[model samples]
Target: MTPTDPGQQGPLVEPVPGAPAAVATLHDERALVIADYHAGYEAGLRIERGVDVPSKAESRRERLLSLLERTSVGRLIVCGDLMHSIGDPGGAERGELEVLFESLPSKLSVTLVKGNHDGAIGAWLEGCEIVPGSGTRVADVGVCHGHTWPAREVLESRVVCLGHEHPCVRLEDEVGGSRVEPAWLRGRLEPAAFRGRDEYAGLEWLEGDPARTGSRPVESPAIVVLPAFNELVGGTWINVAGQSFLAPFLPAGIARGEAYLLDGTRLGPYRSV
Candidate 1:
């Protein structure tokens, strides 16, 4: 639970312009947050898709370092997918992870919310805190990988930051060509969708009255679905017909979700955009 000292201000979550990252301001410290780093993605592409490509590991590390400097955050939170392999990470991936951590400022703390692709990561990575895939609270905000139902405590936050869907949208040009761009999905949580689920069993609402208003059963937290930090990864084309979400509880877990581009362009309703 977040502290409620009358003297301290609440945490604020703000996305970085033109980047797949956000800055979360806590009472005493700020955090740089991102999702789906997918380290060593090039090797995965070669093994799985047979597409040989050059590694962008150094570039990724540099970009993250730049964001850290720009945001001047004291901590870095990776929502999930810090690694690309589902099993043991390859040599390249491990090396990339090592160099990335070594490059960080000595005082900057790191947190990794375990994701589906992060099965093999553990204590070997120094200076990194690995939390459960369900989620964890940082002040008033909840951070999760979004592949499964979040823990009850996480659901109770004022806002929730999630990844794993790698949301994007298909845009069509006047010449009949189409391009896909990374997108952000913003919405409110639906208690009914998660109330009786395993992760949310025995949960109780402390705010709002659904019986009186005929609206949501409880006070819902704002949900922010972040875009993948690695531009090389494929994502769910949210507005395209027949393109479904990857998260198990998404589309149902979120209510009235609207899509936005990385540049902060609101595309209106995701279904109609």
Candidate 2:
């Protein structure tokens, strides 16, 4: 389960004395990037439909904090969608975020990149640093939430990290049983990469040769599609065949990328692509 690329170091998880697991970095120092937290999503669902799901925000926060403490990362960059509301922060969402933030060690710095779900949270996030879709460069890497392709100007950066569509892949055990696990996929963009591919046909914007004049390639920027930090359990699997919505997000023509299975104490990379 070691990575094929010698340059690719660290499984998704690494050990820290008091924390159960920490998301390791492929590149970067004193920084950790995570996406699609969707804070207060359950409460939002309840308000919208009166569904009765148990509140799990506190536990999720504890897990995130444990990772943060374990990594001892000086900075935490949320690619986008810190809250699940389309426009404004709901009472529950706000309260949960408040609790989560308050629980963080004062030594840590937090940054939020606005995703499609962060529409009106700006007012609520008065003093916190917020980056719009334009994105930010950290340790020579570009980061954004992957709801839409970045403008050509922004894509010029060397590495792009993002989140939005929570990416997962189904894995079959030795006995033929299956389970869905969160995955990280990486691919290199080539000319006309997704042409004729049914999974990517619907994404007309991604079909043509990126090198062609006026066609900007939406490549995976050392991209890291994080598991949903919230309790909701649906995601797009990159390993499946056919027209996957995630096809356009990865490097063109690659049906799947290497898989890093994250167990509580150990993270191992299994070559799947």
Candidate 3:
């Protein structure tokens, strides 16, 4: 799929060659952001489905290398859930994780945002820096694994990138059949909606530290919820009525945001489903 055009002036984040639930590559930062790698997905299938699939470490590694080669990015920012199991990873899962990271170029800087499913993820990656539970910032962008409240620093960015909801859309055919496809959700944050909530802390902190953002105007930032990188996991259809969002910061009680297909199709106003 073609990369989606990020039509903004500063600190642009665009969907890269991997699409329909792919990597989010930063144009200005020369960095690549991906979510929900779930490295040992085959292990889950083995346990749950009673089906034995070989470890996908080599294939997944090769795929990621191709994306890096395409983007030529020096940094890889994993939003979260690099592994599937929230508890201890099985032997196959651990081996896969080791193989994947070991294959990465030593020159690359890899950052992982702690996700709810990432219990003691550091045991696998000895030196990689894992951001706090709230998330971290890179230039004018904020990155998080989603599942929880973002830290005050994450709000300073003009754009906030997150994962964990595995956002998607359900499309119904005229024949009354429906299918789900991974999608990107882009929407502006309403500051008023955050009032009295923990998320409003970031906004409040920005109030006192007006100089924190330097020259960039600290307007309400846009939220970009990424689709899962691994297709094995199911998704939450953002357009489906009465669907509960995993992230507390999401639009409350409203059909909102635009959904884009992996091939750069603008699904438009996701609220309409």
Candidate 4:
């Protein structure tokens, strides 16, 4: 489906060719949007898997800086997972973030939609806008971290963007070799899954709000699930059997899910791909 018209709606998002980022226009400001940065991920790998690899913080920072320059966006919107640690981010991770932010133009605004991995980021980060993990609505676009149900306001937008699944696909050749590639998942929201009691519990229907009582959702916004910006992290293999989505509302919330490669190759239905 086509993105919301830039002239009619106050927001528009266009994915950069061969890139993990998208340029979005929110109101009058243009922003570069990315997700699951997972800064200092190498440190996590060392601690969790005993793989002591050298840090790639400089490269990650430079990559982001290059994107900002190429896109010429005035704002940066990180959907979530700006930090690798869930709590008490140490000096290295915090230092990487500081240097990264310092490297950006002083005029560029930054917005971080707090993710499950960013529970304590605010304790050290500064000068950036941090929205609730439930989600936030900026103009006609909705953004969330995708670990839980988005706010009702976010669900009602013309389009919803999220990360956390870090979706990927496995490609196998006739020679029995295979490779994993990052992928983008796009679909329309299924109203039944969000509204039904059994499908997802504790979803706020806002039934107590007199204005919203008994009022079904007015729209089924298109949903865009982003690939992780950090390549070192693991991902959910959407095309693999027995693989399940990490988001609580996903799989059930999506309709006609389609996958696309970073180079813009359409892979048709994600399940079949």
Top TM-score hit: 1
* Candidate 4 segments exceeding 4 Å error: 1-11, 197-219
Order of the predicted models by TM-score, top scorer first: 1, 4, 3, 2
For all candidates in order, the CA lDDT equals: 0.85, 0.60, 0.75, 0.84
Worst 10 residues of 4 by lDDT: 199-208
* Model 1: lDDT of residue 237: 90
Q: Is candidate 2 or candidate 4 better by TM-score?
A: 4
Give per-residue CA lDDT, model 1, range 17-90, as digits (tens). 88999887766788988999999999999999899999999999999999999989999999999999988988
Candidate 2: give the clashing pairs.
160-221, 199-243
Write candidate 3's Cα lDDT for 13-97 as tens digits.
Answer: 7777335333444554477788888988889888979988777677777878888888778889888898888888888888888
- lDDT per residue for candidate 4 within 72-187, as digits (tens), equals 99999999999998888777888889999889989999999999999778877998999999889887789999998888778757788899999999989999999999998988
Candidate 3: list runs displaced more than 4 Å.
1-8, 18-28, 48-55, 198-218, 253-256
User: Best candidate, lDDT-wise?
Assistant: 1
TM-score of 4: 0.89
Error of 2 at 236 (Å): 0.5
In model 1, the clashing pairs are none
List candidate 2 segments past 4 Å from native: 1-29, 151-154, 174-176, 190-221, 246-256, 264-273
